[model samples]
Structures are given as C-alpha cells and as structure tokens.
Target: MSTHLCSPQHVLVLNCGSSSLKFAILDATTSDEVISGLAERLGSDTPSIKYKYNGEKQLIELAKGQAHDAAIAELVKLVNELGLADNLIAVGHRVVHGGEHFTESVLIDDNVLTAIEKTAALAPLHNPANLLGIRTAQQAFSTLPQIAVFDTAFHQTMPNIAYLYALPYSLYKEHGVRRYGFHGTSHYYVAGEAAKLLGKEREQTNVISAHLGNGCSVCAIKDGKSVDTSMGLTPLEGLVMGTRSGSIDPGLFTFLTQQLNYSVQEIDDLLNKQSGLLGISELSNDCRTIEEAAVEGHPQANLALDIFCYRLAKQIAAFLVPVQRLDALIFTGGIGENSDIIRDKVITQLGFLGLECDEAANLAARFGKEGLISKGQAHAKAFVIPTNEEWVIANDAARIAKEG
Candidate 1:
C-alpha cells in the first residue's frame, strides 16, 4: 500500500474506542504510514468510514449504522482488496490498561487474551473495546500473529514510592488499587527522541516529559526508565485535561454527595465529562477556543488557562525529585506540540531550574514542527518533539512476533 517499495516488516495497528476505531498500516522498519483509516459513529444513526490509501482520501457511508463486527469486516475486505494482507507481518492492538500483568509489548496468545479480559474491570470503558478490536483482528488475520501494546506498560518500572496509595495497603493488595500511569507509548517515544537530541544514550539520560493533550500526564525518566509519573490508578489523576478534572480533592466527592444529592455516576460524569476548561470557562473544551477567548480578555477563559498552566508547571517541577539533574524538558501531544503560549507559560514558571523560553524558537515549533524552544545557552533546555506511538507499536509488534 506504500507509494514506495514495502519494507520487510509492516504492521496493522488498531486503537479502538467504545464507539470508534482508528487503524493504520505502517512500515515498522522505516516508520512510514501506508494506509490510515477512522471509523466513527458506529452503531448509531449514521456511521461513516473515512480512510486514506494510495495517496487519496475516501469516505464510505453506512446508512444502517454498522457495529464493530460489520465495520471490522468492511475494513478487512478493503485491506484484502488492496493486497496488503500478505504485506502485513503482524497486527498490533493498543490496549489501554494491562493492570500489572503486562510490562512490555507481547505477542498475543489465548492466555494473553484471557489476561486482558480479566483486567477489563480496571479499565471498564477502554479494555473491552481494545479486546473487541483484538478479537476481530484475530479472526481476520487468523494465520498472522496479533500483538498488544499497552498504555500502562512503560510506567511499570516505577517504584512503590511513586505508585503506592496512602489510604490503605489492603486496597492495593486486594483490588490492585495503586497508581498505573497512562500515555506510556507516547511518553516512551518522546523520551527516546529527547535522548537523541541531547546526544546521549537513553540509559544516560534524565528528563521530564509533559504529554499535554485532551488528556495530559507528566513523566519523569531517570536513566531510560520511568521513575515517577503524575497519573495515578486512572488517567484522571494528573494535570487538568480538556474535560477531566485531574487530581481533584477527595473530600469534594463526599461534599457533593451530601450537599448536592449527587450519585456516584453523576459525580463521575461531572468530573470526567463536564469539567476542565469547559467547566471553568463555561465554553468549549478545545484549547484553541479557550486560548483565543483568553486573548480576548474573557475572565473565565483566562482563569481556566491560568489554572491549567500553573498545575502543569507545578507537576513538571515536582518530577525533578525523581531525576535530580534535568538533561532536558520535553513536551509532546496535541497541545504540547502546537501551543506556543501554553509552552512558554509553563516553562517560564520553571526559571529557577535554568529553563527559559526562546520566543523565536517556541513560535517556530508550532503546527507539528519540532524545535528546541529554550534559550540556547540555558543549562536546562526544553524541546517540542512530536510523538509517534504508532511507530512504537508497529516496531514492538514486529520484534515480538519475530521472537515467536
């Protein structure tokens, strides 16, 4: 499917959501994308499949509203028609939570599938969809291997001090209720890229990576391994996100229950769905909208952004304890890679650490471009390195499948 000659290893990666699915065929060796597609509004009134292949974009409408089974079937048919089945060496599925069972990417077997199912309760919304994608992909590529890449796998190296909860020891032992970070694939990708920029081997590198997007988390990497991260047992425990009220006070839950007569579900919905920039600004959840509104001197918009940047700056500074000497500070993700204002605001707050934003450099790194957004002579610099999680997944799939 690639415009050029196909590499020896190509992987079909699937990242499934409850009502949507994203897929891509990538050359693992060269990190080049061959085919990319998104299926949205599945099992609804009007479902649609949008894809890019052979350097052209196309869309297919499903009037009857196809579910996962039918949508996956259509995708498999498209791949077969394009003659990419034989070119694909493995199928990689992105599983959001491995729940301590998985520490790294692995070739999926019956045991792995069962283990993934067992952990579904921990990620009630994500793991099941991930499993569905894997199961369907297994049916389509019966003879080929199916591999799994997890969002929590890279942070499995964190010590007890970084992941343990103080509430109760029994809660963690009986229910596995300890911190398990998310966005591992993104963090791992950028950390390696940051190491490359610093001209140091990964094992010799120490840095903090802020993955600011619709979902945000800050990771502290000490000598190539994740030592600490802001996210806890769930993705809702870190920096303020587009919708999630990250790291809220536990007492507020009780206060809402007693005072407002709010149920557990209502509280959950309020925090995860109606909070963050949308709640504070009383407007859109999108950062661009909030940033533009803030520039226009909207009071709530300015407050929302100010709080977001302050929290992010605090976490980035707190992570310094894990990796005492900062080699570099890295930013990646939708907002991190594009927003010069957010980046400058967060970095300038860390002036004590010798981090200073260079206006020209920061401005130049927007819209998917990569650049060092720090004063050239600063002892500790910052960078805008776009993450490539799919590349990491494809290569992991290729390597683990070969190990079999």
Candidate 2:
C-alpha cells in the first residue's frame, strides 16, 4: 500500500500571476477550504485585494503602483489579521513552468529558487510573478518552510514520444522547446477522482480531463499518468481560450511579420491577448457574454462557440485513440464547470464514441461539485468534477515537508 504522510494542521497556498495574486487557506487534515480570494488589477489605478475568511468578505484598497511583492505582503497581512496565520504550518506556491527539471513538488531552498529563476524566460509572465510570491512569502514567514508546487510538474510523466517536438534535435538540446503541459495538478487530481468515482483503481483507469478556463488544456491520463495532452511547449498551443488563439499556423506569423509589417512582440500580443473567443466573437471574451450575444442572433458569437466546442471535441477524440479503452471523460475549470450548454455540445459530438450526455445532470453539477452526467447505459462515463489545484499543491507540500 502507498503510505501518505500525516497531514498538516493548515497550509497556505499562493497563486501569483503577472498582475494578480490569489491566496487560499486550507485545513490540510480534512482537505477543506478555509478561505480564498484574489488581488486584482495590480499596478493599476484601482488596485484592490479582496479576501474571505470564516464566511466574511474583506477588501483592501491599494494605492496606485502596487507591485507584486507589495500585493503578497498585503495578502500576508490580511491572513494574519484574520487569525489564521497561527495555524499555518507551511506555505505552498504555484509555479507555472518547471522546465524539464522539477518533476514534483519540492521544498524550497536557495538552490531550488535559483533553478526556478533560471527557467523564468520559459514563462515570462508567470514565473517571475511566482518567484516574487515565493520570496515575499519567505520574508514574511521566515520561520515556516515554503514549498514550490509546479503546474508543469505532474506532466513530467509524459513519455518521450509525447513530450518531444518534431523539430531538430539540436534545437531541443540548445533550447527547451518541447511540450510541457500546464494545468497538470488539476488534471492529475481530477483523473484520480474520476477513477475513484468509476470504482476503479487509478492505475487501471483511462480518462480524458478537459480543463477549460481562460487558460485551457485537455489531458489524456492512462493508468493515472499523462500519456498525451493538447498543450505544447506553452499554454498557447491548445484549445481556444478566452483571449488566446490556442493553435495557429506558424507560417501565419512569418507572413504577418514579413508582409504585414508586424513585429514579433506585436504578433505575440495579437495572438495571446487579442484572439480566441474575443477575436472571433467581436464582443467579449467571457463565455456568458458571448452566449448572450448568440441568443440575440449574433452570428459571430454563435460561430465562436461552435468552433470552440468542435475543436475541443476533436482534440479529445484524438487523445482517445491512444488510450484505446477510455473509462471516463471529465470536465473541469471555469468554463467546463458552469457552462452546461458548452458541455452538452462538446459531448454531443463525441456520441459516436459511445459518449452520451445527460443534459439535466450536466446543468445541475455546478460550483465545485462532482456528478455523473452521462446516460445510464452509456459505454463511457462522463463527469463534471470541480478541480482543486491549490489543495493538490498544499497536500504535496505538506507531505514533502513531513518527510523531511
């Protein structure tokens, strides 16, 4: 039997993004959420931090020009003021890119921090902010050990064939231009949970987990390990996301730069921030907004929604070929959890593969709950499992800390 370390009393989790900080406090023993909230619009005119603890909401108004470090310090202050700091046994930070080095969560040390910094160029928007959260938390909680739980770590199990790019070997050796799938912790958690729901050992299960949020990826889990995933070297090479283009022809970028007089930076901004549902809808990136527009007879909004579901279904089917015998299909993340219509459409396209959606069940599974949403006699299990990436980070951190 695999032994798990005795859980900690409490663990604080931090998810720092380019311009925002989200923090969570968890009761490690029960894996229950104590509180969670976000610091949004960082470095902007109305930079603000909102936190909730013990079922009460609190807001912190920041002066203009608040940096990431300052935002983290403020989060620390709020947690302490709420009297939860006394129970904090260790800190867990979400690091986006671990390159090829970190395969699992590791206790943070000077060397580990340095190694993470060296990989910053791989995830410029995420790694820097993540590093800042780690350092700032270290300074604030000097007596406690901090752990780095990576988003890319869970995907390290991907075989060589699945991770390697067809590009020249020399380029792979010179630069780390290979697939490092993101949303791994979520995929890892949900896949195991799906196996349990199916009354099967995780190691004997085959599942496809779709994590569809602003940033999205579909992971193919075989025997509890990632066999294939939609995301490539970066989060950019996957299904259509809120503002991201997902996957675009490489030749288009070259054509834009050479013929249309666009710079590399301009191309990156256009694809990463000005594309996807927003570009196609010509409205808002929010799915709710797009759905509203579609209801009002907006052809572009309907097209964007259709294309998003079709692409997602197509990719999930592609991953299914490798697993051969898929036991379950799981949908998690912001869009997947709440958007019943989108879930129905995606699953409808997969009916040929013995996937049948129970529309009523899909509509009822919402707000961090898990439920079966496939017809009773369907050959494959379809489920909606709300993901808990922060809890995964905290569990790993607490386990590693206990071991040491």
Candidate 3:
C-alpha cells in the first residue's frame, strides 16, 4: 500500500469497565468507525471477544481468568495482523472521574495518571479499570500518544451553588465532596447534535439532555457548557436507574442499619444493586420488561413506570432553573433512544414547559436513528438522538494529537 499525505488516520477509543473492554477504531478524518468490538466476561470461567470488521462479525475465545491486559494484547495483535497499526495515531481512554483536575481531555503523562488514580476513591468501580486500560495501552503502543477524556469534565463548568450539597461547608472544603457528574461526553455530544438539529449555533443553544442507560444522568446545558447535572459525587445520586436507587432520603441508610440490623455494606448493596425499578416492580431492572408487564396490567410494574417518569420529569424541571430558558430536550442512551412510552410519559408531565411529544415521530425513531418528537409550533421541542461517546473520545484525541 502506498502512503499518501491524505491517508485516513485512526484513533482507537477504549472504555474499560470492571468486566469488559469496549473499543472502536475510527477514521479521524471522516469520523467513521473502521472497526468496533467488545471483550467481556473477563476474569471468569469463559472469556471472549466479539469483533466486527469489513461487515463480518467474529468472536475470539480466550483462556479462562484472562484479565484486561491480556484482552488488550489480543486486540493489539489483531490490529497489527490486519496491517492497520501503522496508521494508528493515538489511543483515547474514558476516565470516569477526573474530579476537578481535568476540565478538558489531555494527553496523558505520569502526573495525569497520578491525578486519575487519586480520584479513584470517587469512582471505585471505574477509575481503576480506566487506569488499567491506560497502562496496558501504553505498553502495547509505547510510541503513540494516549489521551484521557473525562466523564466529569463537562460538568466541571457548573457553579458552586449548583454542585454544592447542603452538608457542612467543611466537608466540601476538606474532603473534596461535591457533585461531579458522569456521562458528560454523551451529554456534551448530544447537546451539540441537538443544536445542529435545531439549526442554531452551539454558542446560542440551551437544552436539557437525558442519558438513560443502566446508569443515567440529565444535564442542563447553556451555550454548550454544562450549567448543572443530575449525578452527584457518584453515579448513584441521579435518576432511578436499572438498579441504582436515585435520590432517596439520606437518612434511609441509617434507618436500614438501626431497624433492620443491616450492615453498612449490606445497605449499600441494597440501594445500589437491588433497588430502583427492580425493587419497585419485583420483576426486572430492564425498562422494556417493566413496560411490557405494565401493559399486561401488572400493578407493581405500572407503579414503577409511573415513578420513573414522575421522578425524571421532576429532575428535568429542576434543571431548567439553571438555564432559565430551554430550546430542546434530548433523549439518548438505551432507554432514552428506544422507549417511546417512557418519553411520552415524561413529556406528558412537562406540559407546563410548552413541550408536546409527537407520538408518531417518536415511534419512528428507534434503533439509533434521530427524530424530532414534538408537536408543531411548540416553544421547546423534544428529540431522540443517539449518543456517540466513542466519536467524542476519538475527536478529542485527534485534536490533542494534532496540537502536539
């Protein structure tokens, strides 16, 4: 193959979870994905990687108990065997908690890695895996630049009033305790996309973006900057999630311990792993399952669906206070993009905002397609746009690599 000045360069974006590694190689010039895959069920009896290339999907099995480092090594070997390693420019990692240290994506170095590690306490399940990916990638591709894009970076723009908890100021001053929202890359990307759909410049766009996955967050964006967000300190503080009980009486923890003889760890496990939709419906954590049961006249399922929509609408209303004006409301992520029933229920409660959902349009927007789901002449509209965090990560890496 002949090399040319305009040859497409690729940036590999990695999102390392506790038990899985999701990756995508995207053409930096055109923002198109060349390949995407997931290596999951690691450190278990069965570990495997599913990769897609040239429109063909294949799976690679690994020995049991393989870890992230070994998973990434296999990926690197695959890239090299395909003769694509030479065109790889950089690797971008998704770091879940940057705290206050990173307001933007930065090329990683020793000090940056240390800062990320320091914030590990704020993100026990995420930061360590993130750092692992960073370290492993460094060893696999020592010559290329590695960038850290933070999940909390966009919400670092929030003012003190919005992020501060009502707890004593000394806790925040001494312990670094405050709201540090997650899913910022998704929020920021979809906000920009929302602006384009509204035919407005990013600087003039104001909106509320909801990312409703297993872990969910809602962001209030003013002129493209996050003014406020739902998740606080940790990801467990926001909307009712697949398993996470969103916001609850802070004293409930003590109540469980005192009255129920539950240990602190047990209470934590209850709220974070056993509550929310699953607890409410006594069925499944999945929204689809709950909606289906509700349609079949299950009382608990109906109650859970009502609570989810009501709580989500309340949070959206609270976020509107930060921006003082709204242009649109965007729904993204699994539940947001695919569930028209939940969207309609949430919007029906927000009638005071002069927003109306166009049911037919919402029905048309599924399987990762964008659609406008608002009635004509409404002051504020609702939209469903697919979130592209990997694209955001790759773009940031490319820009930082070019600057260097």
TM-score of each: 0.98, 0.96, 0.97
Give the Cα lDDT of each candidate.
0.91, 0.88, 0.93
lDDT of 3 by residue, 272-296 (tens): 8999999999999999999999999
Worst 10 residues of 1 by lDDT: 1-10
> Residue-wise lDDT of candidate 2 within 112-175, one digit each (tens)?
9998998898899899999988988999999888999988988898888988989998777898
Query: For model 1, how does the per-residue alpha-carbon lDDT over 1-404 read when each residue is reduced to its tens digit?
Result: 34534566889999999999999999988998888999999889988899998889999787676878777888889988888877888999999999999999998989999999988988888999999999888888899899999999999999999999997899988989999999999999999999899899999999899999999999999999999999888888989999999998899999999999999999989998899888899988899999999999999999999999999999999998999989999999999999999999998898888888999999999888988999856667799999989999999999988888
Give lDDT: candidate 1, residue 149: 99
All candidates in order of TM-score, best leading: 1, 3, 2
In model 3, what is the error at residue 211, expressed in angstroms? 0.5
lDDT of 2 at 304: 96
Q: Predict model 3's lDDT versus the native.
A: 0.93
lDDT for model 1, please: 0.91
Return the lDDT, model 1, position 311: 97
Candidate 3 ranges with C-alpha deviation above 4 Å: 1-6
lDDT of 2 at 66: 89
